[model samples]
Target: MSSTTRRRFQHPAALIGAAVLAASITACGSSDTTSATSPATSAPAPASASAAAGVLTVRDPWVKAADKGMTAAFATIVNDGDTDVTITGVSTDVSRAEIHEMAMADGKMTMRQKQGGVVVAARSQVALEPGGDHLMLMDLTRPVRAGDQLDVTLTFADGRTQTFTTVAKPFTGAQESYAPGHGASPAS
Candidate 1:
């Protein structure tokens, strides 16, 4: 056999030795639940009070102000429970708010509503950022101005709900910037 081919094979004794070594390593690392001398594992950190909502936590929710018709809200939702949490719907003090996602389709920027829901996996987080997953507020009852606070409620799959006081901040970022002439003007 060629040296390269021979190098890939090991003797029977070597294989058996490797197997035994692997098993010993695994056993050494295994946690023995019944062992009296075993130290207890630390519990997970508690969720912050301002963010905790049922098993989900919301952080830094804010809405972008537009010059008229629509705007978007962004936040970080963290799932702290053992099971996944899905955001079913959103309610705002506006005409309508819907969960939406923005993506590049055929080289064009396209925005679409999310029919199912936004899922935050167990022990994980989902961020509703400007140009990505976001909450679209349409038919605004009033203009969202900088320094204004709005109430927003999030409905979850497990019948739990969370309400956040989102602040309106003037942002010049590209991620969630409104289209030209899309921002609504203030009524007289």
Candidate 2:
């Protein structure tokens, strides 16, 4: 081919290649940063409260690894606003999620749904830990193994939602009994 013809083809090819590279970078570029010791924080959501409400964030979010049955997620939900924040519901594509509490019922500790959702007071935080309060993932759509990452969405009472990514790790604690009709037993 002549030099002019070659230049025309090469210019378009270079442009296409650059565009693909840029697209790849954009797809993989996520704001979430996590480490073995550090917690993964969610992006700041708009302050539903006054300007002093600041922002809401989830810290050190993680999930339990399980092949099937049920597992739970642990995190510290921080609310920096002047008004209280209530997480009414939790959701994930991998399973049916619910905010659960382990409380004494009939002389025994049993796991059941939280009655009034989870309330994080103004300028305070709520810790969702094992054997206390947690986000329960039931009937997993697929097996969750160690080192896997999952996206969890928290719906606030004000109709605002914040989605965060959490990594799965092996956890053997919180062996509380499940209430009847909840679902299959928790993974041992």
Candidate 3:
């Protein structure tokens, strides 16, 4: 572990989404119910500029817990430096990591692979939301349920691995409510 300890993060998205889901968390960082997620983890802990002598801020981390073979993760990668941070991979206690993207095809909702990568601009942030982008948790070794705290370590392009803590929450919207780009459809 780096000399820097973990500190409280208040990212823009976390501040905004916290109001909506804060009540859903049962305990301090545990979710009140099972939610939806991406594949497995993010990537393979790649080298990143985000990596510093301090702890990287990964906020709003959420994943779903079903008996299914798939899951997703969402969070904000905040860099406390001036270099552009590229998140190469993500990891969890469940399974390996892979980058995924949700796309609507011919009236059918599907999530596929993201070949390139997800980038967090220098001195900026990146958010993983429902309709936008996220990390996929695949081939779960076990079922992640409510009240579970997911330990995710993100790798940057600079050979730095930053571990973050994410609290699970019940996915608020309907199963088919149409998120915009991902699975959410029937836009009204």
Strongest candidate by lDDT? 2
**Clash totals for all candidate models:** 5, 2, 29
As a TM-score, model 2 comes out at 0.66
Candidate 3 stretches with Cα past 4 Å from truth are 1-55, 103-109, 172-188
lDDT of 3 by residue, 59-118 (tens): 446665544455677766666667667777778888666666667679775666565567
What is candidate 3's CA lDDT for residue 33?
40
Residue 66 displacement in candidate 2 (angstroms): 0.2
Alpha-carbon RMSD to native, per candidate? 20.8, 10.7, 12.0
In the predicted model 2, the residue pairs found to clash are 53-81, 53-82
Per-candidate TM equals 0.65, 0.66, 0.60
Give me the displacement of residue 115 in model 3, in angstroms. 2.1
Which 10 successive residues of model 1 have the least lDDT summed?
38-47
Candidate 1 residues 56-119, lDDT tens each? 6666566776657788888777777788888988889774888888766577676767768899
Better of 2 and 3 by TM-score: 2
